[model samples]
Target: MNQSSSQSSNRSLPDSEYYRAFLDRDSNYDGIFFAGVRSTGIFCRPTCSARKPKLENCEFFATAQDALLAGYRPCKRCHPTDHPGSTSPLIKELITLVESDLTRRWKDQDLRARGIDPTTARRQFKSRFGMTFVAYARARRMGEGLKTIRSGERVIDAQIDSGYESGSGFRDAFSKMMGSPPSGNVAHTLKAEWIDTPLGPMIALADESALHLLEFVDRPGLETEILRLRQKHGLAILPGRTPITELLESELASYFRGQLQEFTTPLHLYGSDFQKSVLKILQQIPYGETWTYAQQSEALGNPKAIRAVARANGMNQIPILIPCHRVIGSDGKLTGYSGGLARKEWLLDLEKRRKS
Candidate 1:
C-alpha cells in the first residue's frame, strides 16, 4: 500500500540484479521493477523486447506509476502497466469448477458452497471477464453443448448432455440460438471460440469461410445476433477450432496488446448493401482516429443519411475489426457503442496511447 519507494525501505532487490534481469529478459522481474530509459523517455517491463539502454540511462522504479511520475511514457511495446497473470486465486478456483462441469448451472449459491462471497465473486469476475460469473458459466456450458452436438449426438441427447431438464425448453433455446433444430449434418456447424483480452472476454463466431461475429461476451443482444446469424446462414453454433477462429485468436491477441493496428481476417458479414458499405467505410477510419456520423454519411455520398449511417453502425455484428466505435457524434462526443461507452473510451484511449 506504500505509494513511493522512498516511503518503503528495502523495496526492491539490488539495482545491479534488476539490470541483469532486464538484460536476460527474465519475466520473474516483471512487476518487481520497471525500467525507465532516459535515452528513449519510455518505461518498460524488465522483460521488454526493446533493446536495453545503457546502465547509466536506465533508472529502476518500483512501479509503473513511479516511472510515469518521473516523466517517462509507457513503452508501447511492453505495456508495463498490465499484468495478465495477476488473476485472483479465488477466480482461478471458480474457473476450474466451471471447466470441470460444463453441464452444471453455476449460481451464487454455488460460490457460497465453495466459501466464496457472491458479491466479491461477481465483482471480480465482471472485472476480468466483463460479465457475471453466472454468464461465464452459461457461455462455458453452451460451448460444451455445441461441441457435444457437433459430435453426432442427437439433438435431444445433446440437450440432456448439456444439462437441460425439459426437452421443450431445450428445443426452444436451441432454435433461438441455432435458428434451426440440431441437425445431423456436421458440416453445418459454425465455430464459437472465446478469446480473452485485457478489455474483456470476446466471443468469436467463424466457419471455414470467414469470421461472422466478433463481439464482447457481455454485449447486449449477443444471443439475438447469434440466432440471426444461424437463421441467415443456416448453420448451428458449436464450440471448436476453425482456421478462421485460430487466426482471429492470434490477431485479436496482437490487436489488444497494441502490436497490431489493422485486422486482416476475412469476414462473412451479412447485411443489406448499405450496411456493408457503411461497415467497409468504418474499416477505413484509420487506426488512431475517429469520425463523426455526418462525416461517414458524407463519405458514402449521402450526406443526408446521418441517422442511417448511425443505424448501420449499430447493426454491425463485428465490432472491433470493423471499428464502429470510431464513429462519434457530430458534436465530437462519443455516442452509443454496443460494448458500452466506457469500453469505447478505453479503445480510443488505447489507440491514442499506442500512437503516442
Candidate 2:
C-alpha cells in the first residue's frame, strides 16, 4: 500500500506541521507523531537522532502503533516503540542512587558532593516526578520511619534512625505525612509509589487489600485528587509498596508490552452509586474497542444521562483498569481525558493494534 493509504486516519494536524516538527527534532512532538519514511520503510519519533528524510518520502502517524500497522518498521537508531523522548540519563542515575539507599536523606550539599547541581536536580525531578528530589527523598525517609514504627520500634528511635535530630521536627514531618503523630495508634495506612512506564511516571496508591488510585503524575488536579482520597479514606499516604501496588506495577508492565489484555489487580473504587455503575460499564468496553458516551448512557438505560456519564468518566480515579479511555464522543472524536488527549489517543491505538 502507498504511504497515504497506510497512514493513520486519526491524524489531527496537517502533514506540513508534522514535517516541520520532524525536521526540528522537537521533543514537544516526541510522542505526538511518528515519521514513516517511505524510502526506508522505517518509522521514528519526532526527536529521533537519525538523519531526516526528504519531505516526499515521509508520512506522519499519530502513534507508534499506527506507523507499525502502516507497514513501517521501527527505526533501530531511535527505537521509536521503546522510549518516547527517552528518559534522561541523569534521572536514571539519580533514581538508582535513591533506590540503593532509600533511608539516606539527600540534601543539596550531598548532591554537590557527587558533582551534581542541586538546581538542575530539582528542576529535572520536578519535571519527571512532579516533585523536587529533596521532597521525594524526604517522603522515602518518612516511609522508612513509618515502617520502623510499625515494626514495634520506639517512635523516638525511628525518628533518630530517619536522620531527624529534633523530636518536634520528626513528629511534625511524620504527622504531616501520616495525618497523625508517629506515637499515635495509627492502625491503617495507604502506601503510594511512583511507577515508571513508557508513557510517563504514575503514582499508585494502595493498602493491603486493594489498589485505590493510579494516575499519571503530570495529570492536572492530581494533587487535589490525592488530598481528597486521603480525606475520604482517613488514611495516611506514605511512599512505599504493598501487595496490591506490586501486583498493579507488574500488570501495568505487561499491559504496556501488549502481553496482557485484562487487569487482575484488585481495586477498591470510591464513588457515588451512579458513578460506580458507570465505571462498571466502562470495564465492559471490550479491549481494543471504543464506546461513545451515548452508547454508555444507553447501556445504563438512561439515554439522557450522557452528560452524567461523561462526568463519571472524568471522576475516574483509576484509569487504565477501569478503561475510561475507551469512551469517546458521538462524532467519533476523542472526548475530554484527564490524562491528556495525546495519552488517550496513544492508549486507544495501543489497544486497537494489540487486539488485532
Q: Each model's C-alpha lDDT? A: 0.70, 0.72
> Poorest 10 consecutive residues of model 2 by lDDT?
1-10
Native-referenced Cα lDDT, model 1: 0.70
What is the clash tally of candidate 2?
Answer: 0
Q: How many pairs of residues collide in each model?
A: 0, 0
Q: Which stretches of candidate 2 lie over 4 Å from their true place?
A: 1-187
Off by more than 4 A, model 1 = 1-176, 179-188
In candidate 1, list every pair of residues with a backbone clash.
none
Cα-based TM-score, every candidate: 0.56, 0.54
lDDT per residue for candidate 2 within 1-356, as digits (tens), equals 00132244356688889989999988898767889886665788888888888888887876654453333555767766445545677766775686465446678999999999999999986765356777655544443433332323444565675455664544444444345532244445777665656565466778899998888755656656766776676667665667887789889889989999999999888899999999999988999999999999999999999999999999999999999999988899998998789989999999999999
Q: Residue 256, candidate 2: how far off, in angstroms?
A: 0.3
